[model samples]
Every structure is written in C-alpha cells, then in structure tokens.
Target: MILTSVLPELILLSADFGLIGSPRWRPLAYQYGAFWAGLLHGWQPNFAVQPVTMFLTHAFLHTGPMHLIGNMLALGVLGQMILERHNTGQFILIYIAAALGGGTTYGLLSHSAVPMVGASGAIFGLAGAQLVWRWQDQPKGDLSHLRRLAELCGGMLGLVVINLLMWWLQDGQLAWQTHLGGTLMGVAAAGLLPAQRPILLKIRS
Candidate 1:
C-alpha cells in the first residue's frame, strides 16, 4: 500500500534517473516536457497540445539530482500523511491541481523564456493541504485554537524565509510564483475535496 501510494514519486525518480543517464535526453525532455511561459503567450511555436500538457509534465522533470531528491522526499512524507487521511484518488487530484495551478501562475506572471522544471510546486501544494488539514483538526471556538493558528502562521513565515533565501542563492531563478499558486490551490483542494475520513472524527474516536 505504501509503495503504491508513492508510485508517482517513484515514477518521477525513475524519469530523472533516465534523464541523468542519457545526457542527450535532458534537452529533449526540457524542450517538450518543461513548462515554457512563451508557449502560453504564443511567442513560441505551438507543438500540438504542448501548452496544456506542459502544465503537468513539467512537474515530472527536474534540473538536477538534488532538486529531484528534495522534491521526492517532501512528496513522500507529505503524500503518506495525506494518504492516511484521504484516499489515493484525492491525493492524486490535489497533486495534479497543484501542478496545473503552479504552471498557470508561472505562465501568467513570469517573463523568463527559460523552461521551468521540477516538482517543488506540487510539493508545496501538499504542504498547503497538510496545513489546511492540521488547521481544521484543531479545536475551534476556543482560546487554545488561537495558539495552533499562530503556529501555522509561523510555519508559513518560515516557508517564506526559506523561499527568499533560495531565491537569493539561485540568483533569482527560483519560481516562487509557482509556489504561491500551488499553495493556494492545495488549500482550496483540501476544503473542496472530500476526505476518506473526517480528521476530527478520527482523532476523537
């Protein structure tokens, strides 16, 4: 069950390995798979559904081993946590929504002609969904709940700081727009999608 739940992550890792082994494959994959904002603006040549497909495909590609490992690790942890509370289908939906949301935001906001790759946006989405679930599980209509809310806020602030540091380290190459979009979509998906079991009910029981 655990392996099956992480099938997507495994597939992504495998794809990354394949790309790494065949140096030539990386360029081809980036050309066809990575999300290019120019494709949306019609500045680049249309390639038969590439604009739409790139939204999800880009999440499967990574810039390097470290990038792939970082995203997969986060996905593995967050995916398992979500699976514990939701079904496989819900988890998949959230992931896809996040990828699409991230791509859309990047396309709309970023002016870079360079193709964007990596699953960080989807990882952030999972984090967002987890945050929502955690918040919802807290005791409401009470003073104690405020503490939990503060903690959540602190976590968000930490994420922002991390993003800023990464952006600076990467020389402003970090696609933060994607992260913002994915997070918003993940939070929305958590509320909109039905859980496999009510978290609070499970906790109380």
Candidate 2:
C-alpha cells in the first residue's frame, strides 16, 4: 500500500524531469492538485473540485525528486510501524485525517500564493503517531522508564530543530504549518484509535 501511494508521485516526477510523458503534465498536476491558500479566499480555478480535493491530492504531489524521496522513505518506515499495531483501515484513516489536518492548517496560517505540494505533512503525522505508540509501550509505574520518555521528548525537540534548519535553508518556504497540524492530528488519532493485541503462538511438546 505504501508503494501504491508512491506511484503517482513517481510518475509525476518522471513527467516533470522529461523522462517520459509531456513536461506539461507536471504543471497541470500542480495546477489542479496542489493546495492553494487563495482558494480559501474564493479564488476559484477552472476546476471546481480542486478546492476540496487538494486537501488530499496535494499530498501526492511533490516539488522535486528529493522531496518525493524523503517523504516516501518516511511513509514506508513510519507507516509500517503504524500498520504493525493497527489494521489497514486504521492506518488509512489516520493518514487521511493527517492530510486534511495539514491542509486545513496550511489554509489558515500560510499567506503564500504559491501552491503547496508534498507528503511531508502526512509523513510528519505518521511520525507523531509513532511517538505516541512509543510512549504508550513504555513500562508503567517504573521510575527507570523515565529515561525512555525523556528520549521521546528529545526526539520531538530534534524534529523542531530540523524543521527550523530546513525553514532557514529554504528561506521560510517550508509548509511548517502543515507539519504542525498533521503531527497534532496524528497524535490525536493514535490516542483515539485502538491498538491490536499481540498474537501469541503455542508450541506443541
């Protein structure tokens, strides 16, 4: 399923790089698929559905090859982690929720007229859910386990540092608001979703 989610982006990248298909495909995809803050302000494009569909569609688009690769890697790793503890439906639900959350956040906070595209928001959501699972899996009522919680805090701080560095490097072009919203939704979803029970096997003697 993770691979399935990556196919559209790969195809789009190919078109954008002129490897196959018309180069125009990339621009068209962005025109219809990328989220535009202006849309929220009643700036309608030719496509009527774009205003609503862009919430999820923009996640499948990428600004460049590196952007796609990074998000896909995170999706594969963190997504698998999520799938291990929940059913496919739950995974999909969390992903969709995160994407919508990210889009909503971007719509509200960002003033850029440029279309936003990327799966980083959804990927960050998976990371957030993974963090919650780690916290839940820790041994309870044990003072020694405090170190694990601290490590989780450190990990979150590290994410903040990385976001800051990327924002600085990109000249504040990063959609950090989307990342923030997605992560919060992911954490909320993980808390609300049920975890699967561990399967046990019996050995015959």
Candidate 3:
C-alpha cells in the first residue's frame, strides 16, 4: 500500500525530468508533473473542476527531490505503523481525508498564487491519527497512559515550535496552514473509527 501511494509521484517525476522524452519542461512539465498536478489535470483552484479533486491529485505531486524524499520518508515510517494497527482501507481513508482537508484549507486561506504541493499534510495527518489511537486505547487511570500522553503532547509542541521557526526563517514559504488542517482532519477521522485494543493494552492486561 505504501508503494501504491508512492507510485504516482514517481511516474509524474519521470515526466518532469523529461525522462519520458516529452517536450514538457520547466513550468509546464513541472506544473503538470509536480507540486500542482491539478493545473495539468484541468482543475484550477477556484475556477474549474470541483476543488475537492485537487485534494487527492495534489498529494500525488511533489516539488523537487528534497520534497519528494522528505514526504516519502514520513509516509514510509509513520504509514507503516498505522497500517500495521489498522486495516489498509482505514489507513487510506486517513490519508485521503487529510489530503483533502489540507488542500481545502490551503485553497481557501492562502493568498499566494504559487501552487501548493507536497505530502506533508498527509504525513501530519498520519501523526494525528497515531496520537488519537494512542490516546483512545490508553488505560483508564493508568499512570503509564498519562505519561505517554504527556510525552506525545510534548512531541507535538516541539513540532509546532519547529514549524513556526521554519515559517519565520523562510519568510512564510512553509505551508503550515495545510499541516494544521491535515492534523485536525486526521484526529477527527481517527475519532470516528471504532476503538480497538492496542497491543500494549493486551500486554498490560
């Protein structure tokens, strides 16, 4: 499933580098193959096909090597854990919901004309889902559970601080907005799922 999620990005990237021998290059090929596939797919923000489609399409696109590698790394690591605990379908659901939520938030809120792209939103969504899952299965009145939640909260806070610092240092190029939206959507989506006994819970019991 992780491979499935990554295949589109790889195919589009092949097109971007002119590896496919097509004339499309730079902005044309880049716009079509990377970051904002929505433009090439005939779905311009605020003008063409339903914006919702962009949510899914944009996620499959990426800006550059660093962008692609960073996102894929997160997807590989976090996605694997989530998929192990939940079914593939549920993992996919969280991903889709997070992408849509991130894109929606960016489309509605960002003032920049530069096309938004990347899997950070969905990756953050995975993190959000993991947090929720941990919290949900935490034992009642267990000090260990409380400690775990606290640690999780601390990690989240650290991430937020890092994002804020990056946003400032980079002169607001970072899409913290999408990250925020994706996280919220992930948590909400995970909350809707029926609770399951985590492996840790089993061991403790």
Best by TM-score: 2
Q: Compose the digit string of candidate 1's lDDT tens values, residues 24-89.
A: 556777888889998877666548889889998888877766776677778889998899999888
Considering lDDT, where higher is better, how would the candidates rank from best to worst? 2, 1, 3
Off by over 4 Å in 3: 23-26, 29-47, 144-152, 165-171, 201-205
Alpha carbon RMSD to native, model 3: 4.4
> Per the 3 Å backbone cut-off, how many clashing residue pairs does candidate 3 have?
0
Per-residue lDDT for 168 in model 2?
A: 100
The TM-score obtained by model 1 is 0.82
Candidate 3 local lDDT, 49-72, one digit each (tens): 534456666676666667778788
Can you give the TM-score per candidate against the true fold? 0.82, 0.86, 0.78
Q: Global CA lDDT of candidate 1, please?
A: 0.79
- Overall lDDT per candidate, in order of appearance: 0.79, 0.82, 0.71
TM-score between candidate 2 and the true structure = 0.86
lDDT score for residue 105 of model 3 = 72
Answer with 1 or 2, whichever has the higher lDDT.
Answer: 2
Candidate 2: where is the Cα deviation over 4 Å? 17-20, 144-152, 197-205
- C-alpha RMSD of each candidate structure in angstroms: 4.4, 4.9, 4.4
Q: Highest lDDT among the candidates is held by which one?
A: 2
